[model samples]
Target: MAISAQAREILDIAVAASEAKLGINPVALEVTDRMPFTDVFLVVSAESPRQVNAIANEIVDELIKHGHKRAKMEGKDEASWILVDCRDVIVHVMLDEKREFYALERLWADAPEVPIEVTPR
Candidate 1:
Protein backbone atom coordinates (compact mmCIF):
# COMPACT_ATOMS: atom_id res chain seq x y z
CA MET A 1 0.00 0.00 0.00
CA ALA A 2 1.08 3.59 -0.62
CA ILE A 3 1.64 6.18 2.10
CA SER A 4 -1.52 7.78 3.41
CA ALA A 5 -2.21 11.53 3.07
CA GLN A 6 -2.30 11.92 6.84
CA ALA A 7 1.10 10.24 7.12
CA ARG A 8 2.53 12.59 4.48
CA GLU A 9 1.20 15.61 6.34
CA ILE A 10 2.69 14.34 9.60
CA LEU A 11 5.98 13.78 7.81
CA ASP A 12 6.00 17.35 6.54
CA ILE A 13 5.39 18.68 10.03
CA ALA A 14 8.04 16.42 11.50
CA VAL A 15 10.60 17.37 8.86
CA ALA A 16 10.00 21.06 9.33
CA ALA A 17 10.27 20.69 13.10
CA SER A 18 13.52 18.79 12.84
CA GLU A 19 14.95 21.33 10.42
CA ALA A 20 14.04 24.08 12.86
CA LYS A 21 16.55 22.52 15.25
CA LEU A 22 19.11 22.26 12.41
CA GLY A 23 18.56 18.56 12.03
CA ILE A 24 20.80 17.21 9.23
CA ASN A 25 20.07 15.03 6.25
CA PRO A 26 16.41 14.45 6.99
CA VAL A 27 15.27 11.49 4.91
CA ALA A 28 11.74 10.13 4.73
CA LEU A 29 11.24 6.57 3.59
CA GLU A 30 7.86 5.21 2.54
CA VAL A 31 7.84 1.97 4.46
CA THR A 32 4.19 0.99 4.36
CA ASP A 33 5.10 -2.14 2.45
CA ARG A 34 7.98 -3.17 4.71
CA MET A 35 6.56 -2.17 8.07
CA PRO A 36 3.02 -3.14 8.87
CA PHE A 37 2.80 -0.75 11.81
CA THR A 38 3.72 2.54 10.15
CA ASP A 39 3.47 4.20 6.76
CA VAL A 40 6.62 6.34 6.82
CA PHE A 41 10.03 6.45 8.52
CA LEU A 42 11.63 9.85 8.98
CA VAL A 43 15.36 9.68 9.69
CA VAL A 44 17.26 12.77 10.73
CA SER A 45 20.79 13.37 12.02
CA ALA A 46 22.15 15.74 14.67
CA GLU A 47 25.64 16.92 15.54
CA SER A 48 25.38 16.09 19.27
CA PRO A 49 23.28 14.40 21.91
CA ARG A 50 21.78 17.72 22.90
CA GLN A 51 20.74 18.40 19.32
CA VAL A 52 19.29 14.92 19.05
CA ASN A 53 16.94 15.51 21.95
CA ALA A 54 16.13 18.98 20.71
CA ILE A 55 15.13 17.71 17.29
CA ALA A 56 13.07 14.89 18.76
CA ASN A 57 11.37 17.24 21.21
CA GLU A 58 10.54 19.72 18.45
CA ILE A 59 9.07 16.97 16.30
CA VAL A 60 6.92 15.63 19.12
CA ASP A 61 5.76 19.11 20.01
CA GLU A 62 4.79 19.94 16.42
CA LEU A 63 3.03 16.60 16.01
CA ILE A 64 1.01 17.18 19.17
CA LYS A 65 0.22 20.75 18.15
CA HIS A 66 -1.18 19.39 14.90
CA GLY A 67 -3.52 17.11 16.92
CA HIS A 68 -1.47 14.00 16.27
CA LYS A 69 -0.83 11.85 19.32
CA ARG A 70 2.70 11.09 20.40
CA ALA A 71 2.47 7.35 20.56
CA LYS A 72 5.86 6.45 22.11
CA MET A 73 9.47 7.64 22.62
CA GLU A 74 12.72 5.82 23.24
CA GLY A 75 16.47 6.53 23.80
CA LYS A 76 15.92 9.98 25.25
CA ASP A 77 18.19 9.17 28.18
CA GLU A 78 21.04 8.24 25.90
CA ALA A 79 20.12 10.82 23.26
CA SER A 80 22.25 8.89 20.80
CA TRP A 81 19.33 7.69 18.78
CA ILE A 82 15.86 8.86 19.76
CA LEU A 83 12.81 7.34 18.16
CA VAL A 84 9.57 9.31 18.18
CA ASP A 85 6.54 7.25 17.27
CA CYS A 86 3.71 9.36 15.90
CA ARG A 87 1.26 6.71 14.70
CA ASP A 88 1.72 6.79 10.90
CA VAL A 89 5.14 8.40 11.07
CA ILE A 90 8.01 7.01 13.13
CA VAL A 91 10.79 9.59 13.44
CA HIS A 92 14.40 8.72 14.13
CA VAL A 93 16.54 11.48 15.58
CA MET A 94 20.12 10.36 15.91
CA LEU A 95 23.58 11.80 16.42
CA ASP A 96 25.84 11.93 13.35
CA GLU A 97 28.08 9.18 14.63
CA LYS A 98 25.20 6.87 15.46
CA ARG A 99 23.53 7.66 12.16
CA GLU A 100 26.66 6.74 10.25
CA PHE A 101 27.04 3.53 12.22
CA TYR A 102 23.44 2.40 11.88
CA ALA A 103 22.99 3.55 8.23
CA LEU A 104 19.20 3.26 8.33
CA GLU A 105 18.90 4.53 4.74
CA ARG A 106 21.33 1.89 3.60
CA LEU A 107 19.49 -0.80 5.52
CA TRP A 108 16.19 0.25 4.05
CA ALA A 109 17.59 1.01 0.62
CA ASP A 110 14.83 -0.86 -1.10
CA ALA A 111 12.20 1.41 0.38
CA PRO A 112 11.37 4.39 -1.84
CA GLU A 113 12.31 7.76 -0.39
CA VAL A 114 9.61 10.34 0.10
CA PRO A 115 10.99 13.58 -1.30
CA ILE A 116 10.90 16.46 1.13
CA GLU A 117 11.23 20.10 0.09
CA VAL A 118 13.73 21.43 2.60
CA THR A 119 13.88 25.14 3.15
CA PRO A 120 17.42 26.46 3.22
CA ARG A 121 18.48 28.01 6.46
Candidate 2:
Protein backbone atom coordinates (compact mmCIF):
# COMPACT_ATOMS: atom_id res chain seq x y z
CA MET A 1 0.00 0.00 0.00
CA ALA A 2 1.21 3.47 -0.91
CA ILE A 3 1.55 6.07 1.83
CA SER A 4 -0.39 9.30 1.50
CA ALA A 5 1.47 12.58 1.28
CA GLN A 6 0.37 13.66 4.75
CA ALA A 7 1.45 10.36 6.27
CA ARG A 8 4.82 10.50 4.53
CA GLU A 9 5.39 14.04 5.79
CA ILE A 10 4.66 13.01 9.36
CA LEU A 11 6.96 9.99 9.04
CA ASP A 12 9.77 12.17 7.72
CA ILE A 13 9.49 14.55 10.65
CA ALA A 14 9.43 11.73 13.16
CA VAL A 15 12.53 10.13 11.62
CA ALA A 16 14.37 13.44 11.64
CA ALA A 17 13.55 14.09 15.27
CA SER A 18 14.66 10.62 16.30
CA GLU A 19 17.94 10.95 14.44
CA ALA A 20 18.64 14.39 15.92
CA LYS A 21 18.00 13.35 19.52
CA LEU A 22 19.01 9.71 19.79
CA GLY A 23 21.62 9.22 17.08
CA ILE A 24 21.15 5.51 17.22
CA ASN A 25 21.14 3.31 14.14
CA PRO A 26 19.27 5.01 11.33
CA VAL A 27 15.73 4.85 12.69
CA ALA A 28 13.26 2.73 10.80
CA LEU A 29 10.02 4.52 10.02
CA GLU A 30 7.64 2.26 8.13
CA VAL A 31 4.44 3.24 6.40
CA THR A 32 1.83 0.55 6.73
CA ASP A 33 -1.24 1.51 4.72
CA ARG A 34 -2.82 -1.83 5.62
CA MET A 35 -3.73 -0.63 9.10
CA PRO A 36 -7.29 0.56 9.48
CA PHE A 37 -6.75 3.19 12.18
CA THR A 38 -3.41 4.67 11.17
CA ASP A 39 -2.01 5.06 7.70
CA VAL A 40 1.58 4.73 8.91
CA PHE A 41 3.53 2.91 11.58
CA LEU A 42 6.97 4.27 12.42
CA VAL A 43 9.38 2.07 14.38
CA VAL A 44 12.54 3.54 15.86
CA SER A 45 15.12 1.84 18.09
CA ALA A 46 17.32 3.41 20.77
CA GLU A 47 20.42 2.10 22.50
CA SER A 48 19.13 2.64 26.03
CA PRO A 49 16.01 3.42 28.01
CA ARG A 50 16.88 7.11 28.32
CA GLN A 51 17.49 7.35 24.59
CA VAL A 52 14.23 5.61 23.88
CA ASN A 53 12.30 8.09 25.99
CA ALA A 54 14.14 11.00 24.44
CA ILE A 55 13.34 9.86 20.90
CA ALA A 56 9.71 9.38 21.76
CA ASN A 57 9.42 12.82 23.33
CA GLU A 58 11.21 14.51 20.47
CA ILE A 59 8.94 12.87 17.91
CA VAL A 60 5.86 13.92 19.89
CA ASP A 61 7.00 17.54 20.11
CA GLU A 62 7.87 17.68 16.43
CA LEU A 63 4.53 16.18 15.45
CA ILE A 64 2.56 18.56 17.68
CA LYS A 65 4.50 21.56 16.40
CA HIS A 66 3.75 20.42 12.86
CA GLY A 67 0.00 20.71 13.63
CA HIS A 68 -0.77 17.14 14.63
CA LYS A 69 -2.93 16.81 17.72
CA ARG A 70 -1.91 13.94 20.01
CA ALA A 71 -4.23 10.97 20.13
CA LYS A 72 -2.45 8.95 22.89
CA MET A 73 0.97 8.17 24.45
CA GLU A 74 2.15 5.03 26.25
CA GLY A 75 5.26 3.75 28.14
CA LYS A 76 6.91 7.01 29.08
CA ASP A 77 7.77 5.96 32.61
CA GLU A 78 9.62 2.70 32.04
CA ALA A 79 10.99 3.73 28.68
CA SER A 80 11.22 0.14 27.52
CA TRP A 81 8.99 1.31 24.70
CA ILE A 82 6.87 4.37 24.00
CA LEU A 83 4.00 4.69 21.60
CA VAL A 84 2.73 8.01 20.28
CA ASP A 85 -0.51 7.85 18.37
CA CYS A 86 -1.56 10.74 16.16
CA ARG A 87 -4.66 9.31 14.46
CA ASP A 88 -3.05 9.05 11.01
CA VAL A 89 0.29 7.74 12.25
CA ILE A 90 1.58 5.82 15.25
CA VAL A 91 5.22 6.20 16.27
CA HIS A 92 7.02 3.51 18.24
CA VAL A 93 10.27 4.35 20.00
CA MET A 94 11.82 1.42 21.78
CA LEU A 95 15.04 0.35 23.41
CA ASP A 96 17.14 -2.05 21.40
CA GLU A 97 16.26 -4.94 23.67
CA LYS A 98 12.58 -4.17 23.60
CA ARG A 99 12.58 -3.65 19.88
CA GLU A 100 14.22 -7.02 19.37
CA PHE A 101 11.74 -8.71 21.65
CA TYR A 102 8.72 -7.14 20.02
CA ALA A 103 9.96 -7.48 16.45
CA LEU A 104 7.44 -4.98 15.08
CA GLU A 105 9.11 -5.07 11.69
CA ARG A 106 8.34 -8.74 11.42
CA LEU A 107 4.78 -8.18 12.61
CA TRP A 108 4.13 -5.70 9.80
CA ALA A 109 6.31 -7.49 7.29
CA ASP A 110 3.42 -7.70 4.86
CA ALA A 111 3.29 -3.93 4.38
CA PRO A 112 5.51 -2.43 1.75
CA GLU A 113 8.76 -1.11 3.26
CA VAL A 114 9.32 2.59 2.73
CA PRO A 115 12.91 3.70 2.32
CA ILE A 116 13.98 5.87 5.25
CA GLU A 117 16.67 8.38 4.33
CA VAL A 118 19.45 8.38 6.91
CA THR A 119 21.18 11.67 7.73
CA PRO A 120 24.48 11.76 9.59
CA ARG A 121 24.71 13.94 12.69
Candidate 3:
Protein backbone atom coordinates (compact mmCIF):
# COMPACT_ATOMS: atom_id res chain seq x y z
CA MET A 1 0.00 0.00 0.00
CA ALA A 2 1.46 3.29 -1.05
CA ILE A 3 1.16 6.21 1.34
CA SER A 4 -0.91 9.14 0.17
CA ALA A 5 0.66 12.60 0.00
CA GLN A 6 -1.71 13.87 2.70
CA ALA A 7 -0.71 11.09 5.06
CA ARG A 8 2.96 11.85 4.46
CA GLU A 9 2.42 15.52 5.15
CA ILE A 10 0.62 14.87 8.44
CA LEU A 11 3.32 12.43 9.48
CA ASP A 12 5.96 15.06 8.81
CA ILE A 13 4.15 17.68 10.83
CA ALA A 14 3.68 15.26 13.75
CA VAL A 15 7.37 14.41 13.72
CA ALA A 16 8.39 18.07 13.80
CA ALA A 17 5.98 18.84 16.59
CA SER A 18 7.18 15.93 18.72
CA GLU A 19 10.80 16.98 18.32
CA ALA A 20 10.09 20.60 19.07
CA LYS A 21 7.91 20.06 22.13
CA LEU A 22 9.78 17.20 23.85
CA GLY A 23 13.42 17.33 22.78
CA ILE A 24 13.56 13.56 22.77
CA ASN A 25 16.68 11.89 21.37
CA PRO A 26 16.70 9.27 18.64
CA VAL A 27 13.03 9.74 17.96
CA ALA A 28 11.93 6.94 15.64
CA LEU A 29 9.14 7.83 13.21
CA GLU A 30 8.08 4.75 11.28
CA VAL A 31 5.77 4.78 8.25
CA THR A 32 3.94 1.54 7.52
CA ASP A 33 2.34 1.60 4.13
CA ARG A 34 0.80 -1.86 4.49
CA MET A 35 -1.48 -1.06 7.38
CA PRO A 36 -5.10 -1.20 6.30
CA PHE A 37 -6.48 1.30 8.85
CA THR A 38 -3.81 3.94 8.24
CA ASP A 39 -1.11 4.60 5.68
CA VAL A 40 1.56 5.75 8.12
CA PHE A 41 2.75 4.91 11.64
CA LEU A 42 4.94 7.29 13.64
CA VAL A 43 6.77 5.83 16.66
CA VAL A 44 8.52 8.40 18.87
CA SER A 45 10.31 7.96 22.19
CA ALA A 46 11.13 10.22 25.11
CA GLU A 47 13.40 9.78 28.10
CA SER A 48 10.56 9.62 30.60
CA PRO A 49 6.82 8.93 30.83
CA ARG A 50 6.11 12.60 31.56
CA GLN A 51 7.87 13.64 28.39
CA VAL A 52 6.00 10.96 26.50
CA ASN A 53 2.66 12.37 27.60
CA ALA A 54 3.76 15.90 26.82
CA ILE A 55 4.94 14.98 23.35
CA ALA A 56 1.73 13.07 22.62
CA ASN A 57 -0.51 15.94 23.73
CA GLU A 58 1.53 18.55 21.87
CA ILE A 59 1.51 16.51 18.68
CA VAL A 60 -2.25 16.06 18.87
CA ASP A 61 -2.75 19.77 19.56
CA GLU A 62 -0.55 20.78 16.66
CA LEU A 63 -2.28 18.40 14.29
CA ILE A 64 -5.67 19.71 15.31
CA LYS A 65 -4.45 23.29 15.06
CA HIS A 66 -3.55 22.50 11.47
CA GLY A 67 -7.10 21.16 10.91
CA HIS A 68 -6.40 17.48 11.51
CA LYS A 69 -8.49 16.18 14.37
CA ARG A 70 -7.41 13.09 16.23
CA ALA A 71 -9.55 10.11 15.37
CA LYS A 72 -8.72 8.33 18.64
CA MET A 73 -6.32 8.45 21.58
CA GLU A 74 -5.04 5.65 23.87
CA GLY A 75 -2.58 5.08 26.72
CA LYS A 76 -2.49 8.73 27.75
CA ASP A 77 -3.26 7.95 31.37
CA GLU A 78 -0.32 5.56 31.82
CA ALA A 79 1.89 7.84 29.73
CA SER A 80 4.21 4.94 29.00
CA TRP A 81 2.93 4.93 25.46
CA ILE A 82 0.25 7.11 23.90
CA LEU A 83 -1.34 6.28 20.59
CA VAL A 84 -2.92 9.11 18.60
CA ASP A 85 -4.96 8.09 15.62
CA CYS A 86 -5.53 10.55 12.78
CA ARG A 87 -7.30 8.34 10.20
CA ASP A 88 -4.50 8.18 7.66
CA VAL A 89 -1.80 8.41 10.29
CA ILE A 90 -1.40 6.78 13.73
CA VAL A 91 1.22 8.15 16.08
CA HIS A 92 2.78 6.28 19.00
CA VAL A 93 4.51 8.35 21.64
CA MET A 94 6.43 6.24 24.12
CA LEU A 95 9.07 6.47 26.78
CA ASP A 96 12.44 4.86 26.08
CA GLU A 97 11.66 1.78 28.16
CA LYS A 98 8.25 1.23 26.62
CA ARG A 99 9.55 1.88 23.12
CA GLU A 100 12.26 -0.71 23.58
CA PHE A 101 9.80 -3.22 25.00
CA TYR A 102 7.43 -2.86 22.09
CA ALA A 103 10.12 -2.52 19.38
CA LEU A 104 7.69 -1.10 16.81
CA GLU A 105 10.54 -0.54 14.36
CA ARG A 106 11.44 -4.19 14.30
CA LEU A 107 7.79 -5.11 13.95
CA TRP A 108 7.51 -3.01 10.81
CA ALA A 109 11.00 -3.38 9.48
CA ASP A 110 9.77 -3.69 5.88
CA ALA A 111 8.36 -0.16 5.75
CA PRO A 112 10.57 2.49 4.22
CA GLU A 113 11.83 5.32 6.40
CA VAL A 114 10.82 8.81 5.40
CA PRO A 115 13.50 11.48 5.22
CA ILE A 116 12.88 13.98 8.04
CA GLU A 117 14.63 17.29 8.67
CA VAL A 118 15.24 17.44 12.43
CA THR A 119 15.38 20.94 13.89
CA PRO A 120 15.74 21.79 17.59
CA ARG A 121 12.89 23.68 19.12
Candidate 4:
Protein backbone atom coordinates (compact mmCIF):
# COMPACT_ATOMS: atom_id res chain seq x y z
CA MET A 1 0.00 0.00 0.00
CA ALA A 2 1.12 3.56 -0.75
CA ILE A 3 1.65 5.91 2.16
CA SER A 4 -0.54 8.97 2.26
CA ALA A 5 0.90 12.42 1.47
CA GLN A 6 0.73 13.38 5.15
CA ALA A 7 2.67 10.26 6.08
CA ARG A 8 5.18 10.98 3.33
CA GLU A 9 5.82 14.43 4.76
CA ILE A 10 6.20 13.00 8.23
CA LEU A 11 8.56 10.34 6.91
CA ASP A 12 10.69 12.99 5.22
CA ILE A 13 11.04 15.05 8.34
CA ALA A 14 11.52 12.02 10.58
CA VAL A 15 14.14 10.54 8.27
CA ALA A 16 16.05 13.83 8.18
CA ALA A 17 16.17 14.00 11.94
CA SER A 18 17.12 10.33 12.25
CA GLU A 19 19.89 10.80 9.71
CA ALA A 20 21.19 13.88 11.50
CA LYS A 21 21.70 11.76 14.62
CA LEU A 22 23.43 8.96 12.73
CA GLY A 23 20.49 6.66 13.21
CA ILE A 24 21.34 3.54 11.22
CA ASN A 25 19.44 1.59 8.62
CA PRO A 26 16.29 3.65 8.66
CA VAL A 27 13.32 1.89 7.05
CA ALA A 28 9.97 3.49 6.31
CA LEU A 29 7.16 1.00 5.80
CA GLU A 30 3.66 1.81 4.59
CA VAL A 31 1.67 -0.09 7.23
CA THR A 32 -1.73 1.37 6.39
CA ASP A 33 -2.90 -1.98 5.07
CA ARG A 34 -1.77 -3.97 8.10
CA MET A 35 -2.25 -1.30 10.74
CA PRO A 36 -5.25 0.98 10.89
CA PHE A 37 -3.95 3.55 13.39
CA THR A 38 -0.80 4.72 11.60
CA ASP A 39 -0.07 5.15 7.94
CA VAL A 40 3.70 4.64 8.12
CA PHE A 41 6.09 2.77 10.39
CA LEU A 42 9.59 4.22 10.53
CA VAL A 43 12.15 1.92 12.08
CA VAL A 44 15.65 3.10 12.94
CA SER A 45 18.48 1.57 14.93
CA ALA A 46 21.11 3.03 17.22
CA GLU A 47 24.31 1.52 18.56
CA SER A 48 23.50 2.19 22.22
CA PRO A 49 20.69 3.09 24.57
CA ARG A 50 21.87 6.70 24.67
CA GLN A 51 21.88 6.85 20.91
CA VAL A 52 18.40 5.37 20.82
CA ASN A 53 17.13 8.05 23.18
CA ALA A 54 18.84 10.76 21.19
CA ILE A 55 17.34 9.54 17.91
CA ALA A 56 13.88 9.31 19.46
CA ASN A 57 14.25 12.79 20.98
CA GLU A 58 15.33 14.23 17.65
CA ILE A 59 12.29 12.76 15.89
CA VAL A 60 9.94 14.04 18.60
CA ASP A 61 11.44 17.52 18.55
CA GLU A 62 11.49 17.77 14.78
CA LEU A 63 7.88 16.67 14.48
CA ILE A 64 6.60 18.87 17.30
CA LYS A 65 8.46 21.87 15.91
CA HIS A 66 6.52 21.44 12.72
CA GLY A 67 3.22 21.25 14.70
CA HIS A 68 2.92 17.47 14.75
CA LYS A 69 1.92 16.16 18.13
CA ARG A 70 2.58 12.65 19.37
CA ALA A 71 -0.47 10.72 20.45
CA LYS A 72 1.66 8.46 22.67
CA MET A 73 5.29 7.65 23.53
CA GLU A 74 6.67 4.42 24.97
CA GLY A 75 9.95 2.91 26.22
CA LYS A 76 11.72 6.19 26.95
CA ASP A 77 12.62 5.03 30.43
CA GLU A 78 14.55 1.99 29.26
CA ALA A 79 15.63 3.53 25.95
CA SER A 80 16.18 0.09 24.54
CA TRP A 81 13.20 0.58 22.25
CA ILE A 82 11.23 3.79 21.97
CA LEU A 83 7.99 4.11 20.07
CA VAL A 84 6.60 7.49 19.10
CA ASP A 85 3.06 7.48 17.78
CA CYS A 86 2.23 10.63 15.81
CA ARG A 87 -1.13 9.51 14.49
CA ASP A 88 -0.08 9.15 10.84
CA VAL A 89 3.58 8.29 11.38
CA ILE A 90 4.96 5.98 14.06
CA VAL A 91 8.70 6.14 14.70
CA HIS A 92 10.58 3.31 16.31
CA VAL A 93 14.07 3.88 17.71
CA MET A 94 15.71 0.74 18.97
CA LEU A 95 19.13 -0.49 20.03
CA ASP A 96 21.06 -2.48 17.43
CA GLU A 97 20.69 -5.74 19.34
CA LYS A 98 16.98 -5.30 19.94
CA ARG A 99 16.40 -4.29 16.34
CA GLU A 100 18.26 -7.30 15.08
CA PHE A 101 16.29 -9.60 17.38
CA TYR A 102 12.93 -8.17 16.43
CA ALA A 103 13.66 -7.85 12.70
CA LEU A 104 10.81 -5.47 12.00
CA GLU A 105 11.77 -5.40 8.33
CA ARG A 106 11.18 -9.11 8.07
CA LEU A 107 7.92 -8.88 10.03
CA TRP A 108 6.57 -6.17 7.75
CA ALA A 109 8.01 -7.61 4.59
CA ASP A 110 4.74 -7.20 2.71
CA ALA A 111 4.59 -3.46 3.36
CA PRO A 112 6.02 -1.27 0.63
CA GLU A 113 9.20 0.54 1.63
CA VAL A 114 9.56 4.26 1.09
CA PRO A 115 12.98 5.06 -0.32
CA ILE A 116 15.13 7.42 1.72
CA GLU A 117 17.82 9.51 0.06
CA VAL A 118 20.91 9.38 2.26
CA THR A 119 22.90 12.60 2.49
CA PRO A 120 26.63 12.22 1.85
CA ARG A 121 28.77 12.27 4.93
Judged by TM-score, which candidate is best?
1
RMSD values for the candidates in order, in angstroms, are 0.9, 2.0, 2.3, 1.2
Over 1-121, each residue of candidate 3 has an lDDT whose tens digit, in order, gives: 4567888788778888888766455333345536667777778778887888788888888888888766578997888888888878788888888778988888888787665667755
Clashes of 4: 0
- For 1-121, candidate 4 gives per-residue lDDT tens digits of 6777888888888899999899998888888988988998899999998999888888888988988875477999999999988789899999999999999999999998878776867
Better of 1 and 3 by TM-score: 1
Worst 10 residues of 2 by lDDT: 23-32
| Local distance difference test, each candidate | 0.92, 0.77, 0.76, 0.88
- How many clashes show up per model? 0, 0, 0, 0
TM-score of every candidate relative to the true structure:
0.96, 0.86, 0.85, 0.93
**What ranking emerges by lDDT with the best candidate at the front?**
1, 4, 2, 3
**Candidate 4 positional error at 46, Å:** 0.2
Which residue segments of model 4 deviate by more than 4 Å? none
- Candidate 3 clash pair list: none
lDDT of 3: 0.76
Please give the lDDT score at residue 95 for candidate 4: 95
The sequence of per-residue lDDT tens digits that candidate 2 reaches over residues 2-117 is: 77788878878888888888646543434554667777777888888888888888888888888977547898889888887866678888888888899888887777667788
Cα distance off (Å), candidate 4, residue 81: 0.5
Return the clash pairs for model 1, or none: none
Error of 1 at 24 (Å): 0.4
